[model samples]
Target: MQIRDLPYTDPGDPDVRSGPRFLIWLGRNQIRGQLKSLSWGLLHQCSIAGLPLVIGFAVQAVVDRSGNRLALSGGLIAVLGVLIAVGDTMLHRTAITNWITAAARVQQLLARKTAELGSALTRQVAAGEVVAVSTGDVEKIGWFVEALSRFAAAAVALVIICVGLVVYLPSLGVLVALAMPVLALGVLPFLPRATRRADFQREKAGKATELASDTVAGLRVLRGIGGEELFLGRYRRASQEVRKAAVRSAQMWSLISAIQVLLPGVLLISLVTYGAALARDGKIDVGQLVTVYSAATLLLFPLRHVEEIAMAYSFSRPSAQRAVRVLSLSRVARPSTVDAAPTGDLYDPATGLMAPEGLFTAVVCGDPDEAGRLADRLGGHAQPAVSQEGAVEEGATDHEVPSVLLGGVPLDELELDAARTAVLVQDKDPVLLSGTLRELLDVPSSGRVTAEDALSAAQCDDVLNALAQASVDSGGDPMDTRITERGRSLSGGQRQRLALARSLVTDPEALVLDEPTSAVDSHTEARVAAGIKALRKNRTTVAFASSPLLLDLADRVALVHRGTVVAVGTHRELLRGEPRYRAVVTRETDDEIPAPAPPGKDEAIHAIDTIEEIEERA
Candidate 1:
């Protein structure tokens, strides 16, 4: 594949069984590319090997005073030089192509897996490990795969040189052949130890990487809790552990490298000594002695490749394993045998909460985890089934498979794409991907709700103005302003509002929002609730929240206690009748019911508020 064909048209199905198997699969997929690399590599090495023989013949011609033979040898030398130059150039080109294609293929697989696994990917694999696998691991894997063809070509060239030497001069050839194998095999005994050290080092490095990534992601929280130094010290120790492991791995590899060099030098020295004695005994000519010495020295080139291939394998094996582990994650929502998304009440039997059609329902859960899980299920992202043994391995949690149904059909049984299109679940901590404000809110483009409408409903005018001021394009609409990754440059409330606006633009048939207004001020939250309720009139909208203002605006509110909906009523009715419901919605403990702050003398005590005024206008 050429550079232009990168991001492969078809990366082909990968073999995720084992690291070695995956590497083999990569080779098999690019057989033509591998052949091209192999052919060029062989031509290059063959020309190099032939050079010594040509030079030896030229020397003999000079010694015998044969000018015609000398001219012929010179012509041959020129041809060999051209051949070497072209062969080496083409070999490098093909090798690079193979490397790029291999890396691209692996990266594509990783991207696909990340999309398939979605938010649950971090639960299955550390975010840092995923980053490491996609970046560093991909290159290592590609390097080893690309090295295979050249290593094989070198081995073939070595064999050809040995066979030719044996035919031309048996005594020296036998010595060199036996010694070459010994040189290649010399490092084998040390490889297992080196590989073990390398694996240990890689494992420690992954841990360090994970720690660093977690620390960076939570830096704001760490600073807030005055734990920056604690995490920094933790990361420092982790980084040191990684360094020590790497040093140990390097020591083992250094020993192997030394052996690779030492054994080849010893072989060359022994061959030179043996060939010199033969020349002294008149069994070999001066030219033949020179040829033997040159060939033995040239043999060192291919010998080094053996060590390289081994080293490549040692480093890439663990990387491949990590990639395979991530690729092997089973998606919670598979393309089902059934192809339709059911219509009607979204029911989660596990939570005993049912959100019916064309209504604004609010679910209040004391435990946020239960609320999040319920929200996930309502949107057809069911947790995977865990058997008794699996549950034990995963830790103590309810192993029962959550049953969620849309209309009457089980959500998991419906096709994944259809389910997603029908239901949208905005998480409590929704992410705003880096892009222009317009692009961020252009998700799926349901065409029922426009960007302006959604932004207004989500109370994002301040956010839009702030982003506009941050934009490089001063004259453009505020919606054209760019948001940084995860909207990090924006305040927490701004990010939350922007994410809510994006979700609003999607306008799914069933919208499940979890704490969509938690970060905003009370007035903003009240406006958001009123606006959403008005815009989503005659549509299904289930919001999980505890704020009284948000719950007060819902058509119906359900109090979820210990993972089950225990009370369902109008917000006011539930507030007055149910003490647990009142406690949760008001965020009050039994020991304290704090008195409302006294209004200033100038403030008017109106019977109704701004939220009511907005509702009256709507």
Candidate 2:
């Protein structure tokens, strides 16, 4: 984005500067939209310049007191007032629009970056910091951009006023001009202190926000364990720190504000003292003396923005810094140096795994987290960690996948849309967006598949019935019923079922599902397992699950331990041959009791419960 075109808000950026490069980075990210906003904003600032000038000219004319000239000055004064008012309104509106859009664009960029980074993002940065950047920091960066435009217009106006006063009033103007910079910039001395305090306040604020988000996200578990008050107390202490920081910040601002008022006030008095002395000595005209003071008085208005710009920059710098951290993350694997997409089955040579063309497969991972990470790598949600040496591991790649071949081409090598069409990872905790049944299921872009078919496959006939019942109770069609945020309105099983159903409707060629049946009761899960197996018979489906029922249905299963596929076989074959695999999959014995204490079993810390517990009459 050539930010130069949007002169007012667009801070002119050097090619590479740590502090301001971030703003330029944003510009490059959304060059076209910002270029348009910049074009409109400069026009706005140009209009704003008229405000101070009009005031200066009007005061000058009043001091002159000539009949025709006075009337002409009066008319100019009226026009100037109208122009400043109109300009302020329009310029502010345009600049604000640019600010909002820029923030939104940056948000989108961060989201896309997060998606690309996927599991790597968690490893690279704190989850809270990521949340803070996306939610709070992006807007501050946008604010700084918007402030740039306003400061530019005010700076120009200040310069024009000083030059005009010098031209019109000579020596008196000299004193006024000299005083203008000193007064306008007098707030600088207090800035360092203010910035430090403001930064402290912002840090406290971010910590508070992160704490609150964590508390809310884990509210269910927190309440269960009686940890609510502990977090609440921590938050309270953090808030108190924030309050203290805020008071310190406000104190420093009060000092800066005082200087803003006092420095110029001092200058105005000094200018009047000198101008009045000259007038008394008949060295300067009374009218000129009056004009000088008036101009000096007008100086205060523009100076306010100088202070404003400084403060805005103070807040935005840290925000920009945070945003920069997020934007700086590059995909580990770079796309191949070729335009043509590959044509063949996707082969993870490390694991001797081939996602053969258009076929359903199941990955029975022992570790759920490892399973999730592997799914991300396979579906192109993550750039594979590069490892080139004597040793290599499964599901890791140093190069981007080719795009054209669907799975044949690396998903990352293809254009975003093409890759997404070929592979869709339905997260185990599929987010059920708050909406009606119809809108939730309606994947508008590809409407080829019907809701009935997807619902059948997902075994969501019961979910639809429940929704319809809820709707009827609430006086609306079940299809139009509202789903609450996080789908708290629905049970875990219901939400998962709905999410699964929604994914089924899209029917992408490669569908990666993680523990898709973990929430639903075994009976419902059995139906879903059977249904998904039948419906996704031809499509390339990889179900990341350890459920015995789901495992039985898969053509084959890979037992992933740590980050590698340690075992893969039919259920019975693995059970009979792989000792570790059998222990993990069938820990429950004939009586449903887990294996009796194996001495030196420090690794199995968790108490494994099974049908044996119930059978023992406990």
Candidate 3:
């Protein structure tokens, strides 16, 4: 496809069997563009090669003192120059277009794969590796793709020059033909070493990048724990390692480059020296000597292209392999053939937990970690559980784990889009992408709730006020305030509320929220809980929280202990009837017994006291 047509509507299914195969697949897909680039490149190189011959004829004409031959040679020079200019310009344009379009296609494929895998992609691949592949590796792969046509044109031009010399003056022509191969092949022996060093450097760089990303993401937490220096030291070591690897890699490539320059220079010097002897011996004239010298000199240019092709492949082969690894990752072996979308209660057979349709359910787990896992499982993206010995737990493999079902159909059995539309799970820490507030909130939604209504239901008046104040100097609207990456500029509580508002706007059939108010104060948490209950009235919602403020608002509460639901009833009933549930929710000890207050009275008093403390602090 042409550059203008890029950003392919579909990048098409890639052959990811191996790195070489993947590179070949990319080439085959862009054959039209490659061929166009090749044609221009051939014209450009051929015109350059023709210049030396035309100049040789001009020299001959001057020696013969023939005005007609001189004039014709001058005309040929002008024509060749024009062809050179046009061919070079178009060749460059087409080659660059090939490069940019190839990179775009790879990026599009990476983005599509990322979307398909979702959170599981990061779990399978290192965040640093993903960053490296999508950014630096993409350019390397594109370089090789664009270099292919140029290299081919250069090779063909070299062949033509050699053949012309052999036919015109066999003595020097044979030497040139034989030595060209030597100059070209001399660098091959060093390529493997250079390639290894390059791969090592890339690996080191990826680790360093990943470390830096993680360090920056947790900089606040690291400072709070007085461990920022420790991470900084580790990162410093990683950076040093990357530097060392890069230097070693550069040293090897420098050796190859030296050989490329040295061999060609030697050949040129030999040809000029030998041709001068032929002219002195009366075997060939001054014009023939000049032609021999010029051909040898011009041959150096195409020889460099040969080295470039080698270098390009060395760098890009590993990059293509990395890309292949990432693209090969599949959340499922195959797409679900079942087109029917299921609806009803969300049920996890593994946990024996059922969140009935059109009801608000709260799950209380003795282990908060388990609650998070349950949330993922309910959304059909469950990760394998690791045993204490660091091995994957049996029967918890991705393919083996029991699927969560809705209306008797397995969630994983339905098309991905259909399943995602039916259920939405917001984990404890939902990231806020960097953009204006309006852009951040403009997600796919059911249109049942407006952005303003969702924001109000999320009790985001303070957040709006803060954003407006921040944007006042810029004279922009409150909704136009730009958030920092991952919403790092906002307080944790503000970020949580905004994420909640976004989720509310989506208005999914089943919404699962994990500790949505974990970062907020009791007063705000209470309002958020009440708002959620009111807004989600007659909709299916599952909230995994232990706060009495949130639990009291649940239509029903399920108590989970040791990975299975043990009790299901109203919050107050479970609190009174199940000791384990009470201990988990209240942080009470089994040995402690106290006089009970009136039913639901304790919760009301607790909520009132928490609100009073929050107001006093404010």
Per-candidate Cα RMSD to the true structure, in Å, reads: 5.1, 7.0, 4.3
Residue 358, candidate 2: how far off, in angstroms?
Answer: 4.6
What is the Å distance of residue 125 in model 2 from its true position?
4.0
Q: Which candidate is the best by TM-score?
A: 3
Instruction: Provide the lDDT at 604 for model 1.
Output: 37
Candidate 2 local Cα displacement, residue 179, angstroms: 1.7
Q: How many angstroms is residue 320 displaced in model 3 relative to the true structure, after the best TM-score fit?
A: 1.4
Better of 1 and 3 by lDDT: 3
Count of clashes, each model: 0, 8, 0
Q: How far is candidate 1 from the true structure (C-alpha RMSD, Å)?
A: 5.1
Q: Can you give the TM-score per candidate against the true fold?
A: 0.91, 0.81, 0.93
Cα lDDT of candidate 3 equals: 0.86
lDDT of 3 by residue, 1-618 (tens): 777887799999998877888899998988988888889988988898888888888898899998999999999999999999999999899888888988999999999988866777777688888999999999999999999989989999999999999998999999999999999999888999999999999888989999998999999999999999999999999999999999999999899999988998889889888888898999998888788778888888888899899988988899999998888776554348677667799999988999999999999998988998899889877745332223443445545667899888888788888877888999899999998999999999889989998898899999999899889454757789998899998999999999999999999989999999999998899999999989999899999998888888899999989999999998777766577877777777767533466686766645544433423422
Q: Please identify model 3 stretches exceeding 4 Å from their true place.
A: 383-399, 473-476, 593-618
Per-residue alpha-carbon lDDT of candidate 1 for residues 1-618, written as tens digits (9 for 90 to 100): 787878887788788778898899999998999999999999999999998898889888888999999999999999999999999999999999999989999999999877655666675577999988999899999999889999999999999999988988898888888887888899999999999999999888888888998898888889899999999999999989999999999999999999988888888878887788888999898888778788888998888889889999999999999988887665543346668766788788887888888899999998898888788778865465222123321422455465577787776666667778778899899988988887787778569899889989989888877877777875657778777778889889999888888888888888999999989888899899998998888888999998878988898999999987899998876765577876776666876543443666223323332435423322
Q: List the residue pairs that clash in candidate 3.
A: none
